[model samples]
Target: MDFLTSSTHLHITAWVVALVLFLVGAFVSKSKGIHMALRLFYILTIITGGALFIEAMDYGMGMQYGIKFLLGILVIGMMEMILVRQKKNKPTTMFWILFAVFLFAVLYMGFKLPMGQNFLA
Candidate 1:
């Protein structure tokens, strides 16, 4: 468990790969295999994120980490909605918009957090 939560590298990589998977699922293919892979990545991301949140709580900023977790979940939900809607031949414009907004918020908060890499912070 310590190994999983020791650093942010794994967390970052998981989410980044999930983002790429999202992009591929968005415009490239609607294959079930891709969707399943994306879902797997989502789980990996949340697990890693939870580990980070526990670490962040040690900094005495639980609220910020909580908000980040919520936003991260929203981002994941939005991704799922977009892909599902896309498959159903439904409009995903709003989902895409929300995804962008939530993703930006989460990523910004991530970089601004104490444990973050001080990326553009």
Candidate 2:
């Protein structure tokens, strides 16, 4: 839809909300309800991210966008891993570290890319 491609608001909002949900799921509560909601936001984030990826291809920056995409997936995977391991009462120090690193990488690339929004640049 035009609204999706017109801006990155949806993608940004999805991830931001997901991050909040992740925090709640990870620290405040281990309820399945929060995890399920987080999963849904993950889907929303991916869909909007895919739209942006496709748009980036038109600019001949497929390689960079592709890397960003992979990093995004890693971030998502790390989030899921942290929550699951937390629920299982296992230590997640490494996963938490990786999550922060990957999330930072993805966000940096997102802002550095030649998109409608580039707050970092």
Candidate 3:
């Protein structure tokens, strides 16, 4: 669909996918099925995010795009650390805090700020 090819559509879709993953991951953190689903969702999140970044760069929105990429990496790293690390230390609280901060930042970028002038244009 033409909408899928549009930058706005891609951006929105990325956010939707990320949110869904976050929610489902939370709900099914202890289940093998949910864990597998979350993992696949994260992989898709990364791919879609990369596509969005490329689109932004192609449109000359480099700084904003770079910030987004960095944030994404930070979030993904946090996620991996939370999910893959051995349960030696109790880090759930810290991970949740980090996730909250990242979510807030994403919201600021997506809704509260002038995204076009801030990042790409």
TM-score: which candidate is best?
1
Residue pairs with colliding backbones in model 2 are: none
Q: Write the per-residue lDDT of candidate 2 for residues 18-40, one digit (tens) a residue.
A: 99999999889879999999999
Q: Mind giving the per-residue lDDT tens digits that candidate 1 earns over 67-101?
A: 99999999999999999999999999999999999
lDDT of 3 by residue, 66-116 (tens): 676677667766665565442345557787679678766765664533433
Candidate 1 accuracy as lDDT: 0.94
Count backbone overlaps in model 1: 0
Q: What is the lDDT of candidate 2?
A: 0.91
Full ranking by lDDT: 1, 2, 3
- Candidates in order have lDDT scores of 0.94, 0.91, 0.61
What TM-score goes with each of the models? 0.97, 0.95, 0.68
